[model samples]
Target: MFDSSKRQIGFAPPSIDNECIAAVERVLRSGWITSGPELKAFENDLETYLKSPRVLCFSSWTTACELALRWFGVGPGDDVLIPAMTYAATANIVLHCGARPVMVDIDPIERVVTLEKLQAAWTPQTKAVMPVDLGGWPVDYKAIGNWLNSAPIRERFQATSAVQETFGRPLFISDAAHSFGAHIENMPVGTQADITGFSFHAVKNLTTAEGGALSFSLPSSLDLEQTTAWFRSMSLHGQSKSALEKTQSGTWQYDVVEAGYKCNMTDIQAAIGRSQLRNYPDHLNRRKEIAAQYTKALETVPWCTLPVLKDATRESAYHLFSIRINRFQSAQRDALMARLKEDGIATNVHFIPLPLLSLHRNRGEHMRHYPESEACFNEQLSLPIHLHLDDEDVTWIVERLCYHVGELMTPHA
Candidate 1:
């Protein structure tokens, strides 16, 4: 019988304390609370943390990245290569731009798209390569950058806009929504890609309540200040000056440059993010400790395949602890999730690859086309890893997980 008095472990809950509450309260008490000083301070903190040249905050990762695609002129007749194993938002943004998202298969173990897979999917219509850092593990940014800049890849370039022409090759925009603190080649994830977008969603490792930011790493030839201004304008309906700027005594007059999207991060949200950022290092360390605990406890299990936390060149953000049960089918995986839930433990899947979604299926994308992604999705299960969980919670969760998995894997009569 399941114990009703036991605590139910959540999948990923935001770590909010008095600091976060006080920060939000301070913002609420301030006279100016929109996109203003707080947001700028938060962006500066991120810029320093990631050691990137520039960073822009937005309402959500979806908005920030979609804006990036638009900036690159990824319109109809263009193809953006992405992995089939990522969330629907990855593909949805491409479709929203009226471009096609050419899905690529992932390495079953790494669960990330490789440069070789991307090379195979390239075409003249390929305008951008937006590979995701699945589960906060970075893709091979160095190799992919080299491949994209190679003579063969560059010679086949098709520039549709001034920004595209300036690059003389396809843009390497990384969907780094899960890799905010992750690193590769002694550099942060944001510095590797031409433009990397990080999610600060409530369920993410860091929460802005609901926000995101983009880190830019374009070539030296472009005017980065102008580029930054343009993105800031676009986020605020293309106004020549921000509402904060317009508040000045005689600076009310401003012009709209172009029709743009309204997705700027609010000062209130930035306050929460700033508070979180202050103690983010400790939060991240705690997550890593929990992941280590889970790995050490479960590695001895015969059927369990633990996730890769670190390698020679890359390290994850410890966003999720996804384990693969060898030979587990989708139905069995679902059953195991249910069994864990019955014990008041919440387990989840990282994603149901784009091919399995109805939106992609209607476009003629088949699950059979991505065998590796299909296999990974079937066996993959994301275990809870959050600040809310302590060592005792991790041990209990692991015990329940192994018990339920063992029961489900037993031979049936």
Candidate 2:
């Protein structure tokens, strides 16, 4: 039923250029494509750009999340709190580490975990709170940090200190896969949480084919350099020297400190990342402009409920332009998507609430427990928002959406 003649707009895709291609070519010709100088340069640039104290590149955000859990010693008896409205990876990492993932509801408008929700879920077994930056919007890091630092929270941690001392004080690990350049209170997402992970997958604003990074905000008592070194070791099969380090003269001798995962980012991937990072500010500006255009174009549509972007102290990276079809049933939502597909305009749902998924449900989570998340999942749709989309593309997608809204709302189809 789809026609190639009608322009096809993808949901999200990488915005590659000659510079990115050249960067990859350079890595390929250097004879050091795996975990070498390019990775080092990329990590340094990322730290400088984000103003974070440390950054550790990885193969994927999921791996980074798992490593963060391991670093915090979250396993077996520990419980980690996560927002119910996030992608599965946010909770999956907890399960990967043998910890329980306690689901909490997000603010309906903001789509982020709130202080009240977090506090209600906090228990003696709760070792960490993971807040997902939904659709590139920065969660209220200040509020969450303040709550964790509060007297009551401190007292709880102190009371359980003997049992949970290894977990290292109710840590805040941010799942910021969509918010690489996002900022809150003049602080970048990288440094906002005690530990934050950023994704650079093909669909993300910063495309690195497939890669991610973890930034740290270690406690005063902990040595930042030592912590980063530990993470570096864990990411490379627990070896004293990485492939890059061993390649140097007289440096071939190394040791394996512990059993660790092979999740280090290669120079080939980092090459693309370095090029993207250099041009990230311009790309981000274009995204912000596109978001503004979409906001203005879709404002008058009664069926649409747009994302809130009025936080004076923070700004999203504008990863996904998600809108809800207000008052629409799940059937109507599906119908709208089908109609859009028939018109050759591609669209997607940002997520289906984790609890509603088969895997999580099989693990004993009920849909009724996350009412708001279910409501959002039933109506939410993601529109295309990438640096490659121009004004014409934005106009075309909005036109199709308005047309489909009318078709679905008619008394009889």
Instruction: Please give the CA lDDT of all the candidate structures.
Output: 0.92, 0.86
Candidate 2 C-alpha error for residue 96, in Å: 0.9
- How large an RMSD does model 1 have? 1.5
Tens digits of per-residue lDDT for model 2, 201-282: 8999897889999988766777788778888999999999988778889989999969989999999999999999999999
- Cα shift from native, residue 148, model 1 (Å): 1.0
| Per-model C-alpha RMSD | 1.5, 2.4
The TM-score, computed over Cα atoms with residue i paired to residue i, of candidate 1 is 0.98
In terms of lDDT, the best-performing candidate is 1
lDDT of 1 by residue, 308-375 (tens): 88999999999989999998999999999988888888989989999999999999999998999999
Backbone clash count, each prediction separately: 0, 0
The whole-model C-alpha lDDT of candidate 2 against the native structure comes to 0.86
Give candidate 1 misplaced runs (Cα > 4 Å): 1-5
